[model samples]
Target: MKLYTYFRSSAAYRVRIALNLKGLSYDAIPVHLTRTGGEHRQEGYTAINPAALVPALVDETRVLTQSMAIIEYLDETHPEPALLPGSALDRARIRAIAQAIACDIHPINNLRVLQYLGRELGASEEQKNAWYRHWVELGLQAVEAMLADDARTGAFCHGDTPTLADCCLVPQVFNARRFNCRMEAFPTINRIVDRCEAMEPFRLAAPSNQADAE
Candidate 1:
């Protein structure tokens, strides 16, 4: 397997963690997202993923896009150390936690979105950062609530083992700290992130640990 990745991309970071957690050794095919006006926009990469996103995976005949979809594919292909937990309800709760970050929080603060807000809309640096903090604060508060209410949450998001929810959570928290989002209100989130980042997979998969980190 080969992964086309950008060093600081949280989405790419998530995939990297998943790959490491599953003990899957894959080649890192770096795609500089911001060099020469985004290499991901180039025709060569657009051919791989028309969405122009980082962390596209090439597994033999199949090429996959979207971090969550790629992760699910990884989980399916390598079932040991499952990324999800038992029971349908538990699975749904875990997914809900994941989506709260992936969909509600991540999209608004994604690189492309922030670039558009600043370059086209004339949003100042402070305003841009405020935009990032706003959504993260709201989203993580809800995640804290979810964690507090759930009996399923253990050392990780869903159980003693890291699940898909923890995979999503760790990356988002990484982003939150990068942008310096207010995290004091979400103690559960902070605790989980601290624990997750201690693991070899999560530590090595961090944005700063990536080859192209600047």
Candidate 2:
């Protein structure tokens, strides 16, 4: 497997964590998202992934795009350490938690959106960061409620083992901290992230630990 990734990309970070958790080794093909006016926008990478996104996984001839879809593919292919293991309802809950971050929170605060805000919209750095913090804080607040109120929430998001939700949660939290998003209100999230960071899989997948990390 070859993973075309950007070191600091949270979406890529999520896939990295999923790969590590599944004990699947893959060659990391660094695609610099910002260098030389963004390598992902170049013809070479766009050919690999027409979406011009990072973390496109190539397993044999199959090319997978989108972090969540790639992760579910990994889970299905390597079922031992299942990232979405459970009954139908359980799986649904896990997917919901994952979507809360990936779909709800992350889209609005993605790097591309921030770049557009500043470059095209003439937003100041402070304004852009404030926009990030506002959405992250609000989104995480709902996630906190979801975890705290649920009886099924365990050491990880869904159970004692790390699942798809945990994979999604850790990277979002990492980005949240990078942007100085105050996390004091989300004790459940902080606790879950702390537990995940202590594990080697999550630690190895961190942005700072990646080969192309600056």
Candidate 3:
């Protein structure tokens, strides 16, 4: 198996954590996202993933894209330590939490989106950062409320075991810290991230631990 990744991509980071949790080893193919106007944009990468996204997983000859789909595939293929919870409602809740960060927060502030805001929309760096922080804080606040309101949230996001929510949360926290987003209000997020960081899998899969880390 092989995993193509970018060092700081939160989407890729989520996949990294999922792969580690499953105890799956793969060739770490580092795809430099920003070396020369983004490696993901190159034809070779686009052939693997027409979306031009980071984290395209190759097992045997099959290449899979999208972090959530890859994670579900991993869970299905390797069910020893399941990354999802039991029951339909529990699964829905876990997916909701993950998507709260992955869809709501991430897409709006992606590197390409930020670049578009600056180059096409005439947004300054300061404005762009503020825009990023705004969505992150808003989304995180909602997640905090959801967790605080629910009894299912434990050391991890979904019960005592780390599930898909935890997988998504830790990477978003990494991105939050990188962008200097204030984390004081989101105590649950910080706690989960701390728990995840203590594990070797999360530690080794960190952006700084990557081969192409700057």
Candidate 4:
């Protein structure tokens, strides 16, 4: 297996964590997202993933895209230490939390959107970061409420073990801290993230630990 990844990309980070948790070793093909007009936008990577996104996984003849889809694929293919474990209702709850971060929170603050805010729309750096912080704080507040209210919430998002939700949560929290978003209000989130960061899988998959990290 080969993974085309950008070290700082949160989506890539999530996939890396899942791969680590599954104990699946793959060749890490670094695709620089910001150097020389972005390698992901160039012909070489576009040919592999027409979307030109980082973190495209090639397993033998199969090519997988999208962080969530790739994660679910890994969970399906490698069932041990199930990332989306539990009953149907439980899975739905887990997915809800993951989507709350990936779909709702991440899309608005990802690199492309931030670049568009500056390059295309002519927004200042302060405005772009403000936009990132606003969405992240609002979204995480809801996630905090969700986790705090749920009886199923344990050391991780869904239960004691890390799930798809935790994978999504850790990366988002990393970004939040990077942007200096105030975290004092989200105790559940902080506690869970602390537990995750202490583990080798999460630590090994951190952006700073990636081979291509600058």
Candidate 5:
């Protein structure tokens, strides 16, 4: 197995955490997202993933794109340490939390979107960063409510054991810290992220720990 990844990408970070949690070993192929003109846009990489996204997983038979899909695939194929374990309702809740971060929060603050804000919309660096912080703060506030109001949120996002939601939450929190977003408002999020970072899988998957990190 091999993973095409960018060190700072939160989406790729999600896949890395999931792989580590499953105890799956794979080669990490660093794809520079902003060297020259972005390696992911190059023909070679695009041939592998037409969407030109990071965290594309190539197993023996197929190549998978999208972090959440790849994570579910891993969980399905190697079911021992299930990423989304429990009843159907429990699973749905876990997925909802994960998507709250992965879908609603992440896409708006992604690298390409920020670049578009600066290059196309003529936004200054300050403006672009403000845009990033706004969405993150708003989204995390909602996540804080979701986690704090629910009894299901435990050591991790879903329960005592880390689940799919924890995998998604840790990376988003990392990005929030990177952008200097105010985190004190979300005490529950900070507590959950602290617990996750203490675990080996999350520690090893952190952007700073990756081989491609600057």
Candidate 6:
């Protein structure tokens, strides 16, 4: 297996964490997102993923795109240490949390969105950063309520073990900290992310530890 990834992409980071948790080894083929007009936009990468997104996984049989879809594929194929280990209701809850970050929060703050803000909208750096912080804080505050209010949340997002939710949460937290977003307001999120960061898989999957980290 080969993972076409960018070091700082939160979507790619989530897939890296999932692969690590599954004890799977794959070649990390770095695709620089910003250098040379973004490598992902090049023909070679577009041939693999027309969406021109980072973190496209190519295995023996197929190539996969979308971090969440790739994660679910991994979970289904490698069920041990299950990423969504629980009943139907529990699985739904876990997916909800993952989507809350992957879908709601991340899309608004993605690199493309930020670049558009500055390039097309003529927004200043301060304005762009403010845009990132506002949405992240608002989304995370809602996530905090979801986790703190639910008794299902434990050492990780779903239970004692890390699940799909934790995989999504850690990357978002990394991005939040990168932008200097105040995290103190979300105690539950902070606690869960701290626990995840202490583990070997999460630590290994960190952006700083990646080969392409700049």
Which residue runs does candidate 1 get wrong by more than 4 Å?
Answer: none
Clash counts per candidate, in order, are 0, 0, 0, 0, 0, 0
lDDT (Cα, tens digit) per residue for candidate 2, span 31-91: 9998999999999999999999888999999999999999999998999798998899999
Question: What's the lDDT for residue 108 in model 5?
Answer: 97
TM-score of 4: 0.99
Worst 10 residues of 4 by lDDT: 53-62
RMSD in angstroms between candidate 4 and the native structure over all alpha carbons: 0.7
* Candidate 4 local lDDT, 104-142, one digit each (tens): 999999899999999999999899989999999999999
- Expressed as tens digits, the lDDT of each residue in 4-96 for candidate 1 is 999888899889999999999999988998899999999999999999999899999789999998998999989978887688888888788
User: lDDT tens digits, residues 1-214, model 6?
Assistant: 8999998999999999999999999999999999999999999999999999989999886999999999999999999889999999999999999999999899999999999999999999999999999999999998999999999999999999999999999999999999999999999999999999999999999999999998
Predicted structure 2, TM vs. truth: 0.99
> Model 1: which ten-residue window has the lowest total lDDT?
148-157
Candidate lDDT scores, in order, read: 0.90, 0.96, 0.89, 0.96, 0.94, 0.95
Angstrom error at residue 141, model 5:
0.6
Global Cα RMSD, each model: 0.9, 0.6, 0.8, 0.7, 0.7, 0.6
Q: Which sections of candidate 5 miss by over 4 Å?
A: none
Positional deviation of residue 112's Cα in model 1 after best superposition, in angstroms:
0.9
lDDT for 102 (candidate 6) = 92
TM-score list, all predictions: 0.97, 0.99, 0.98, 0.99, 0.99, 0.99
> lDDT tens digits, residues 1-93, model 5?
999999899989999999999999999999999998899999999999999999899999699999999999999999969889999999999
Cα lDDT tens digits, model 3, 1-214, are 8999988988888889888988999888888888899888999899999999989999999999999999999999999688886899999999999999889888898999999999999999899989999999999999998888899889889898889888888888888888999999998888888998999888888899988899
| Candidate 2 wrongly placed segments (more than 4 Å) | none
